[model samples]
Target chain A: MASKASTLETEMPTEPTKRLDTFANPNPDRDYQIHIRIPEFTCLCPKTGQPDFAEMQLVYVPDEACIELKSLKLYIWSYRNEGAFHEAVTNRILDDLVAATIPRYMEITARFNVRGGLYTTVVARHGRPPASLERSDA
Target chain B: MLDEAGRRRGILAQAWPAGQSLSPAAWLRHALQLIALIRRRRPSAEIAAIAVDGTSGTTFLCDTTSGRPLTPVMAYNDGRAGIEARALAARGLAEGPASGPYGGPAKLLWLTRHYGAPSGAGIAAQASWLSGALLGHYGLMDEHNALKLGFDGSWTQILRERPFTVRLPHVVPAGTPLGPLCRTLTRRLGLRSAPLVVAGTTDSTAAFLALGSLPVGCGVSSLGSTLVLKIESPHPISVPEFGIYSHRLPKTWLVGGASNSGAAVLAHYFDRPTLARLSATLPLPTSPRLDYYPLLAPGERFPVSDPRLAPRLSPRPADDRLFLQGLLEGLAAIEARGYALLARYGAPRLQRVVTTGGGATNGAWRAIREQALEVPISLAADRPAAFGAARLARAGWLDTR
Candidate 1:
């Protein structure tokens, strides 16, 4: 009963959750691209605990499933208080998205606003791993 | 914030809230809707012409035949073309302020290759594409949009040796009337007559135009996420080494340079409330000489074009107010040096500076910048880019008609 109840709760999200949810792709064969831009993204700096602002762009080609928009928004908001380097955080976002959707291809481009005096843009990508391999490669 | 004289003239003001991250289609639709709404509200007015100013570097590829986007629009801040830019730089094709990955040309190459060259597709900056969409033409670009695309007096040369053949747009001067709004658009919007669609400039240049005209030597400094200085000059200034270039105006050249130093650094260090608090306690100390070269990384393009330049934010002062003041003073010094470098490179003398962007709101920083620049620093005319575009529409197309 407990396991069933937990599964039911997970299936029907009651609030903004970190767990990314996905729906079956309407066009499984076509290789159309999905682009999402998150402009007001904020995270904490690992070193100073100060805030880092970035406009993150996610473009992907889904395989069998596509990410749900509300869940993706919540997934992004989860990083609000997290402290990570630009490169690491960008790659992690890509990693999470690819894992959630098992996308054929995914790219995360995070343009971090100038910190000291330089603007940093970190682009991370993921391609489809071999089907024989059980895990998606970063 | 119109000037006293402008206020007296009583130019009609309208506000339509806008946002970032709009696709090319959305941008066009919103623009049409906004114009239609304005006309509906004021039935007595007849809009003679329309001019647009899009986000400066935002670019997209379109199929000329259908006037439909072939790929997702690459925004100004989108840096997906880093590898393509590196390749161009390796071939010595990357030059000028727009050589970076986010530049229009780089984005063009990336989109072309990525989409495998859809037939009859041409890449264009946001303003060019939007203007063309309105006028029912395709592959027409303005000089400001074409500059980073390597459009010389006549043609764009993406390659140093040969003309770029990816359906390059025909270049036109700003304020030149392209044509009337297409029949479909006119009928849809319920316009009595097809409005003239004038050639447009980039958003930043349009903002400069919104300054309501300045003297030859006068300049404007935009202290947004980055710092930009533009001054009017008789002759064009092209210093690719310092990331400086000039855009042609009707009479003079708008010589300009940009530095990646400004409010972004402050936002990175402190939140809004904290910054407001720190700023309130300013005019603190001009002494103790905290002459620092603040950078987010080890690179600078203007006033000092060292890619390996290191950021200097050491010797932490215990007082938060002191630290804030030091950063402000450091930025002011950079601004001063930037104007000096421009003058050294044959740009106009620093007659006066009209300040724009978020940092301009800081009065203490303004005082510091005034002391550093040794020139009259005043707030820019507080108006949106739409107002500038409207001014261009009036001056370039409406008045002539």
Candidate 2:
């Protein structure tokens, strides 16, 4: 059970707990992560209340704060009851991640298989080495 | 964002509250959205510290006394500006960009001819309007966006030349302090008071911020429907033949030009469904059947200055797929030509390009662009201008202090 804090709201299914294989200190003291997954991941449209099927694999590194999987799971679950276009959903997730965990290096790529006769894969990444990237002056 | 024709454009950055189009209130609404987002992230943020950068050249009519915008802004794309453009050209006062039509002079001319635009409190680009709205004083335009309007950022002229005698906005370099938003707005907009509104910039300039700092030759390709290429320069290169603009980089100029051809043509034949079903059949040829000049419903600029232009496909393919693939090849080739143009204008010859837009996401498209341009072209690593603006806001606030 997640330590429910009054300041933050999170929902976790209580039917039958499926132990998630997760951990910390993977980077020792540095900000980095390497996630391993087995395909199947799903959610529902926030508006139509229809299921939005997707297979996702995420790998992120943090600077200030790292994402909590259970919380992230609930967040993703929340999307199941909401509705949004794919583009909007993808960006909204990225924005939420960035806001939730101030990561130093992060990359999220959504590779949606064929849908409505079109295949769309959207990716957004951000990373800043301690100093500004060479040529930030332009 | 780039248009279907691949023209890199600045965002209006104003709120579209249902049916509202052009007005100071709309501009303020947009600013409020930014403020709300920022406040949610940085609760104690200051107010007076906002500077608004908007789409350059798009003109709006504003009322003086009440500080309201006139209904239905005479748009930048309105061809009605042609008379003014012609008048300026006839008087040897007009300059042309790589592509024809949709320029500041043309829009302004359209304003004069159609509206008989009377001198209001002021007239300026989308950025200036927002800046004026934020500060309550209609006295500024960031120098970054005024170059297209005949306002000189170097000597900061127009005060003398009275270019067009159209009251232009006060030009400030990006990041300049515009003081705080009035306490009235701060309280009304929820929170954050006395925050500094740093002189905001054009969406392109903010995009440049997303590109990181400027040096020379560092070009960003906005590969949307319309392809727009902008590169930083150490000096001004305002040849009308190239469609370049002078900016506030002081030592740098932005070499930009639009493509009269873009995705609209591709969309004409293939919708999202057809494209998915047929990516592989788009011809295996490394070159085009005919050296193509891709265009849409109208004529082209850049390669041709003729305005009454019509979209044409040569060596017409026997099938829709063949033609589209051929069209893609031709556009890819033009992407190369655009880069070559930037190089010719003395922007540090782009060795690699960062792209953001619909076209850039297509793997096959990226391959074609990379092969034709003979350079590594990568999609932007972040979101669009909003990311750029957010990054700018974070860095700018730090710099101003």
**Each predicted complex: what DockQ?**
0.01, 0.02
Candidate 2: segments with Cα more than 4 A from true spot: A1-128, A131-138, B1-18, B37-49, B63-66, B70-72, B97-101, B109-120, B154-165, B190-192, B213-218, B250-252, B282-288, B303-312
lDDT by residue for model 2 over B259-367, one digit each (tens)?
7677767777789878755666544655446666678766555534456677667878677666766777778887778778666766677755656567765656766
* Top model number, DockQ: 2
For residue A124, what is the lDDT in candidate 1?
84
Per-candidate TM-score against the hidden true structure = 0.69, 0.67
Tens digit of per-residue lDDT, candidate 1, span A1-138: 999999998897545444566677776545567888889888999999999999988887765568889888887887889899999888767755654565666778899999999999998877642243343222
Clashing pairs in 1: A116-B295, A116-B296, A117-B295, A117-B296, A118-B296, B1-B382
Q: Rate the local accuracy (lDDT) of all candidates.
A: 0.75, 0.57
- Docking level for model 1: incorrect
